[model samples]
Target: MACRDDDYRFLPIVDAISAINQNVNLVGVVLETSIPRQFKGTDCFCTVKIIDESYSSPGLLVNCFGENMEKLPSVHSAGDIILFSRVMIKSHCGDVNAVFNKKISSFAIFEGKHGTQFLPYQASANFHPRDEDNKFLDCLRKWLLNRNPDESISLFGLNEYLPLEDIRVGEHLTLICKVLHICKVQENKWMAFVWDGTDAPRANMRAKKENEIENLPPLQLEPTPLPRDVLLKFPTIGTILRVVMEDDNQGLQLLNCDRWVKLVNVKCEKYAGLWRCMLMPSSKLQYLSDTEKLISESQRNYEKRLTLKRRREPFSVHLPPPSSMMTETSYTEMPFVTLMDVITHPKVTGKFKCAVRVIAIRPFQSEDFCSPQGIYRITLTLEDATARIHAFLFAEDSEYFFDGYPSDRTLKRTRNALLGVMIPSGRSNEEQQCAQRNPPWVQLCLKSYYTDKNDKWGTRKYRIFATKVVD
Candidate 1:
């Protein structure tokens, strides 16, 4: 069945980036630059890197640009997630001058009049994206609006619900707003939405003098910024939300702010034009406050180190060897990637020590064995990159990895993840015998699905088999 408002949970931008191809938004830290969102609102974008061809070579090169180039952010920091929306998309025919593909990116400069938001977020004990629920989703079918999406609502004084009355732009606002009308964006214009939520005095019924406006000097106000509370319309950035809690008996509460859960997965959707809910929380599991505190601390420490490193070093004349590339330092410097990228890409070798998800699994076969030892390959893209390319992690690495780990989950602490070890699927009986006869007949294998006492998955990582579909 298609999902309704109540059937989905918010996905974080970080999580969404890994599965970006599904028409979902790619979320990551916003790259700050003076270019201004308006300037590059339209253009091509691409990311590139060098790799060791086989065991050795001058260096294998791969660059994504062209049609794919339309997705790049010229000013985004290396570690930031650049969400592309409402842009012309196409693959590039490789720039002759550029190394690899000259995948230039192009997109709207201003990310639209919409602005920043900081709604309720359930930071993990370590502040990473959390997935208390493991169900898959098809698309956002409903929404949990703090106010009616279709109504022109008034902003009652601010934060009326909280005991504090001091109004701030970034603070979470819970006010009693009344509906007047619904509006939308017209050709490059922000649609005017009048509000009558407050009293006639506060309700937006005032008439603007048209002639008086024409006399005013030309102004380039950035945008009519909405408070973070206005973020309810966004499925990702907010906290635990209930888009369609229970459409049947607990029908839609267009005006009921309490009906909506706050925190959410900022990763699921792109930061672009308006979109309805695709997923909503299945449960209201209380996040341990301590977890949030710890996550904040971890982020702080990580950022502190990053800040120091940026000030300490510069460029590299030669690329680091691929095998020895993945490292603790690389994790922060580069955007998140799959194990394949970590191992294959000459630049991203070590960072993937942890942080990957299992999206699918090809069941381990008996024939895949080197002298009775199992081997397997896990396909994955970086959990935080717009790219969704798969990679391999070897059986040796899987088995030799830290103790008591779920082979199906993202490798521990490594930002790069692809479930299980990367090993060739020795599908042919002849290939199996050739290797087995030689001695170590490397056969591929992986522990795909494992569950805990309540039939819930135990690993932070999950596999989404090709045959499977998000609900």
Candidate 2:
């Protein structure tokens, strides 16, 4: 992988890491990178920390900005080589930094393999690499090969790792988990649901007070970037911890859906009776490779969860026997039918028992479960192998399902167990497809009828009744 003397001749003469007060071209190994985040109106930016032979202890920081992500450095892994062209040299907070010039700054990223061919997998549209750049890339690869891999690419700070399920309130700790989904809550705020395949400890809740229910505002909606189908694939039975990242532009740019990441210095606290994790000012985020030990542990837990679920009552048990239900109003013994049969039955009004799994629940937050009338009104998206439908769980049925009146904190765990938690099954492609399937089946009594019996063709609705979920 050694480069010839002629290859060195084409490169511009510049100091390895000491160049200051002047624009200079440089090459360095990427040590860290921020997730790209949108700023201003349409412009996006990210920061990359790099190191070279001359600057070994600490890395030099480079600030990259572009009209869009396409023009920024897309550094996917540590130890990659970045070739900067015409970057402005500047000082920030008493530290030298490279400021990207939109008009003249350009970058090219090369994979850090020792003997791979000299080629840039990612580069700006205007970047045109000459033979000299290839030589520099080769030299960097050789240097990377000779250095100790552990010391070269190991992430710094907050080495202690804690499981999502083990986090205690008021504790600031680091955690490694897979990011199932990231959705904007509001301006400068995002909610990232992360899971490590283990169930989170239930939060402590206080008894409800009469004042708690009075003068509450109407329920409002929170915007999420994920679509229905994507959300439906989230894990049904594990602890999907909610993480709030506030005003963290660099951290936001660093995260992506389905990626495994290490969250450092996250503050865990209880909010509205549910455990919540937030990123503090000192918190740092590092992307983890698929081979990370914590990630593997999470995958094992995920698989075990699915195995336990399979051992539950089979869907066939819910299939109706030869003797059908005698009468619609007969509470003695009603035969169970598939969800499809319940929905498409010829009767304009009918009561039936079906086997289904709860997929998505509306209101998103448990706090909104109470209606203005002080009754619990929740909508559940239930699905069986054959069909998917929405069924209303309100009034007496809602209270019965929850075993009592629903309160924000007291029954948060119960509500989650009934509605199921949302997290993708795994980070790998194959396991991801498996997450799309519905969870184990449970028997539910559903009443299907038209809003107006006179107009049979009008809106049809389904209501869940006489059903209770047991832990």
Candidate 1, residue 415: the lDDT equals: 17
All models: lDDT? 0.23, 0.62
Q: Where in model 1 is the C-alpha error above 4 Å?
A: 1-351, 363-389, 398-471
lDDT by residue (1-471, candidate 1, tens digit) is: 112223333334333223322322122222122111122244332332111111111211122233222233332111112222211212235321112222221122211112222211211121222242211111111111222433201111121232111112222332211121222223322221211111110001111222112232111111333332342232210111112221121112122221211112211221111111212222111111112222345335435534452211111122222223332222233332322222233221123322222322222221231234445343332221111223334455433332223333333222112222222475564443233110100111112332354442222133322111101
Mark the 10 consecutive residues where model 1 has the least summed lDDT: 197-206
- Per-residue alpha-carbon lDDT of model 2 for 95-205, expressed as tens digits? 778877777777888877443867788888777778767777787788777766465435333246787657787756878787887776666666777777654554333
What's the CA RMSD of model 2 in angstroms? 12.5
Best TM-score among the predictions, by candidate number: 2
lDDT of 2 at 256: 72
